[model samples]
Target: MSELNVELSETERSFGLRQIPAGHARMLVIGRCLPQPIGEVWNALTDPARIGAYFAEPQGDFRRGGDYELPGFSRGTILRCDPPRLLTVSWMPAHGNGGELEIHLADENGATRVELLYASVRKRFAVMDPEVNEWAAGPGWEFFLDNLSAHLDGREVRPTDRDWQSMEGTDRELYEARNTEWVRVREEFEREHSPLPSPE
Candidate 1:
């Protein structure tokens, strides 16, 4: 058991973090507050044109059961689309691995809260080194969410030069150790930012 951590931006109303369950699995959620109305944020996430401006080479269709391919990112079928509220999809990665991403939006105070839940990531590499596997998901989600937040707020979020630059040279044994540490802190962060009370 580890204490989840929170990393808040003093300069912006955005934050990101990770959560892991020992040797079982990991879940990552990253998002930000949009100064614009909920409808605008909804469009930015659901609109093909708006999504292309932030992530992927070009935006694909947004209808449920339709193809949602973004050049480099995994291509998959849209599982659900409840317009302005829920957008769920299954993403297929290059290695034949895939996962589901659920985007939820709600009106909070005056700003729209966008929550992205990237779950059930393939545990394909977890056996190799659960730690290293844990390493990839969080940062990857962070990168994507940061871009989404920036785009929604009319800011540009540049991709990092190297993805794993932060985890370069740590010993093999400590990889998972540090991963758990990050997971603990990240979970804490989510609890704090949660718009509603967490379900029991």
Candidate 2:
């Protein structure tokens, strides 16, 4: 199978997406900016301690061909890892049933531009859809980035461990609705701010 490729430029001030052919379909390319240097941002992403501080359990060697294991979200081998620049990993669950996540970093005026290239997502993993990941990568990562910046600036950002394994009918419905709205808003946002250029 030919690997998918997503190229994103002008990311510090905008976001971009590209659909590439691989096996059966196209994968989404999501990205954003960070308010810290490349090394700081890279460490925040690759360092298990720092990642756990913001999100859930994070364990990975963060190198080419090394596997990263998180309890639920994803678990797979790293395909590429360039310190303070790029980290591409294959995300799988149940041993071997998933695809890849490619993260790119660029330096812009002392801050780091972080771009997430989520590729080769399988159809079976469609239930926990892109909307859910948006909740995590979009708003969730924004939340984490804010905390990371604060911590880097010598401020305090307390970590939390809250489990909500159970929710009533209305609660679950509301959660799903909100996440749907998030996806919509994110699409609108990208269109407005970084409208895809017309093909020549």
Per-residue lDDT of candidate 1, residues 1-200 (tens digit): 22212233311222232232212223455555666677888888776767777776545665777886767667887888887889888766666555667788888876787777765435432222434433355445555666777887678765433334344443232333434444565556558866422212
N/CA/C clash count, model 2: 0
Q: Write down the worst ten-residue block by lDDT for model 2.
A: 2-11
lDDT of 1: 0.57
Return model 1's CA RMSD, one decimal.
9.0
Find the candidate with the highest lDDT and give its number. Answer: 1
Model 2 residue 60 CA deviation (Å) reads 4.9
| Model 1: residues with Cα > 4 Å off, grouped in runs | 1-26, 57-61, 124-135, 160-162, 166-181, 185-200
Q: What is the lDDT of candidate 2?
A: 0.53
In model 2, the Cα lDDT at residue 48 comes to 82
lDDT of 2 at 32: 61
Q: Which residue pairs show backbone clashes in model 1?
A: 4-184, 4-185, 4-188, 5-184, 5-185, 5-186
